[model samples]
Target: MSLLSVLRAELAFGMTPLLDMASISVLEGERIGFIGRNGSGKSSLLAAMAGRLALDGGEVRRRDGLRVVLVEQEPALPLAASLRASLAARGGLRAADLEGDDWRSTARLQEFLQRFDLDGAIDPQQCSGGERKRAALALAFASQADILLLDEPTNHLDLDGIETLENLLIDEQRGQRAAIIITHDRRFLDRVATRIIELDRGALQSYPGNFAAYESRKALAMQSEALERRRFDRFWTQEEAWIRKGVEARRTRNEGRVRRLERLRAQREQRRERLGSVSMGVAPGERSGRMVAELEGVSKSFGVRAIVRDLSLRLMRGDRLALIGPNGAGKSTLLKLILGQIAPDAGTVRGGTRREIAFFDQQREALDPDKTLIETISPGSDWIEIGSSRKHVIAYLGEFLFPPRRTEAPVRTLSGGERNRLLLARLFARPANLLVLDEPTNDLDMETLELLEATLADYEGTLLLVSHDRRFLDNLATQCLVAEGNGLWKEYVGGYSDWLRQRAPPPRAEPTAAAEQDGEDGAGRQARPLAQRAAKLGFNERRELESLPGLIASLEQELAAMQERMARADYHRQGPEQIRSDRARSQQIEVLLEEKLRRWVELDARRPA
Candidate 1:
């Protein structure tokens, strides 16, 4: 039996149709992985199923008396209270509210908190964002609802927390529970989901199996769409050519043919809307000296608490370094010290010769919330100067996907992903060599994140970044600086995955000798569980990885064309926006090409040669 069902659902945001004539069903024991681009209505559709939002049309039905729990992306937990107190207040687990056999509920709640790395003794007010989120997750699980709806549950979780969450959701009990998860972490979805559903073009589409299976299927669908569009395009071209010949050619009796051409035009526009090209116009900043920033015995403390202590590191041009650690691990503090916003207590922080830095702070320190999109970019000037050439403000805003109608909208009105894009746009405008970004992926959707990855891929300067998105870090970082909270720092070659392997504890010491001799059963019991925890991938990923090299070469060829164009003497004569836009595209392609190349090599190396 289905846990919930939606039939002929229709939803609209202003004039924008989100879901139209869409039907979806949640079945018992089914773990659905929901995916779509941002604003594709994944969250809204979930809300509809949970009866939190009213649908414009159609019906939603849930099993009578069924309990549903929703864990929001931005957890709405009480602040100003202890984390334990907040959790204990739920599920009738409180000491005062507890009845017979209710102590188990309280114990279960405690276990959840511990698993998420949230100590029950800590105050929610004092906890960092990630800790607060952990507490929220604990609360959601403790509810013991019949169905669970989680939105981006992995966002702020550390690597260990992410793995633990995966284990909990994939275990027998939780695995059979009816639930839907919306996550951009492909790895997480692959591990936890039994099936995949994508919300695309105002419809719900399902694909059996996991993320890899969905990707394989989605690729085939895209190929089909491309072919169909090509066929239509050929037909449309012939009709348009005939129609344009003369007024007599478009006879009154054949008026239907002209209307058909108009319908074809609309269909083409719809297809373009569904699958858009990526254009990241992040200008490659000026080149700096070989060394960009250096930290020598840097120490920082806030009264009794130490954040960074005797930490030493150097940033070199062309270095793509990712800073990773726990919530309060001083990644942001380190970025500040390098930028000279704050001084290190016991060490020297210096920049390389001619180093100009651009910072994309998670808080968006450079943006003026009161300013409109246009004002933020060009201020009062009607034009923005890109390398001494002036480009119209509206045109400049367009490069970052801001439509002309929305150019005057206040920055505060933009969504988090849009704001991040704005931050990147502003950051790229500066001719800087050192780019330091702190938690830039905080609320960005997958598409924006992918675009940012491409832009930074071609970045010719030094990059120091802190992000929780594993995919983002894996795609860009040349090295990783791991901040082991409390001032300990470790540098690992490659990305977060490499660091995880480097940090993994060694295996247990052969059953402690004496215990092994006690009995064969004792040895067997000890060894049984240790042998249970190990794994690998399947066909879709292997196939995708194998195809990356060819894709990479194609991108490189296109990148070379952009580069060749930029090298022409008259390139600058093209409007400054065009010149800069081409350069940004060149950089984006370069980054994407390298990403594919690396992925192909990694996947290839895992096998015979």
Candidate 2:
């Protein structure tokens, strides 16, 4: 059953078309992942669907009295109200009303707040970005709306928060509720989406499945579309050649052929071409010393709170490292210490020789809102040097999807994603042997994210990245430095998923003598001896546990071999079926490895102390 439908939507900004005859429907029990390039009006489409934005032409039809909620990318709350009061207002209830007879409503609201780990009495204005996002989500979920329009809900969320949201959204699949989400988190989409809707060149295209399935299907579609386009162009070219023949031939040309040629010209004129991808490159400066940066027993703190306690690590040349932690985990402080911008409180930090550094700030503080794009890229001259070649500033901005008209516009006019792209444009314009990026993937579109990932993968410089994007970290990081609570940080080999596999669970507390004698713990569960726990497993389970290590090793070898094959340039150019098959197999291996690792952990927990 359809909850809402958009009919031939047409919208435009000035001379640019934002939604050109675009249409879509929201059906019950469907979670749609809305995607597109940056500045392609994805947010606007959400607004229109939520009845917050009026279309210039066409209409939106909603089921009678259907409740729809729109969660903005950067949600704004009433400054003077408490978080609980804000939710009350959003749900069309007064705070006083909630305090009275509506026990169910109040309980529901509190439940969501608790689930999101938010304080209900806190002022909305005092909340952090992640907290604010959680507040908005809590409001959305508590509203019990028929359809939810969520824009970048994962923007400021940490890995744990993202996982929580993924589970909640997946649970929504069992109900009649529906959602249309606009996000750049690929893993989130793969986990939560029942279908994918793409907004490309002012048109909406739907793909039936999750992100991985969308990738495979879109690849094949693009290939077929390319072939069809070539055939059309070939015929158009022959018609053009015939029409341009001598005047005598034109006078004698068949009337029917002339009409067909005119129709062809019209058809060609009305066609919209696909937007080009971003062309990005880095200029790696002169090689630095083999040791990039090293910290000896580094410890940092503010007053009584320890940020990084006795953390020691060495960064070598060509090392691609990632910092994973919750917000306010002192990632910025760690970066500053490594860069020698700030001294550690109790340890020695050393920087390598001849190291030129470039940084991408997550807050985009380095960008001046008043400056034009051209001025930002090339300050004093019309041309700038990129590695040995000098290129016009306007041309360089164009490569980043900034039109010539927009080059002279101030940075404040650009959207969030556009601002990030501009920052990337500025960052890569310079040469550096060390790159430190903090949350660089926050507002980037998927295409730009993939391009940046590829560019960084090919970079010769040592990289230090702090991002919450799981897929991005998996693709690029060679090592992960994870924050284990209470200022302790640990380093693991490989990326985000690697850290998950290698990390051990917190040790269980030993039972007291009294509890041992009683054969029960304080929680009233059985407190078995180590031998008894080991013997509890069935024969099949024991066999599986013993075989897990071998299975894990075999899968890792296969995954590594597949990765090596994919590293070759020719692997990507293979047929769509082969490419899709390889991608599916790779994902399967990763999933299997993670499952086995989890089982191994479970089984290993029962071993003798």
Best by TM-score: 2
Q: Write the per-residue lDDT of candidate 1 for residues 37-94, one digit (tens) a residue.
A: 7777888988887788999999998888888877777765564356777666543345
What TM-score does each of the candidates earn? Answer: 0.78, 0.89
Measured by C-alpha RMSD in angstroms, how accurate is candidate 1?
Answer: 7.7
Clashing pairs in 1: none
Give per-residue CA lDDT, model 2, range 1-609, as digits (tens): 999999999999887788999999899999999999887889998998888899999899999999999999998887546888877876678778777645887888788899888989998778988998998898888777999899999999888788878878887557899999999998788778899999998899999988878887887788788899999999999988987874343455476788888999999998889888889999768898999999989999998889999989999999999999988889998899889999888989989999999999999999999999998999989998999888999999999999899999999999998999999999999999999999999889988998898799889999999998898899889999999978899999999988986899667667667766665445324565444545567778889889999999999999999999998978878975677667767765776676688788777776546
* Clashes within 3 Å, all models in order: 0, 0
lDDT of 2: 0.87
Clashing pairs in 2: none
Q: lDDT for every model?
A: 0.75, 0.87
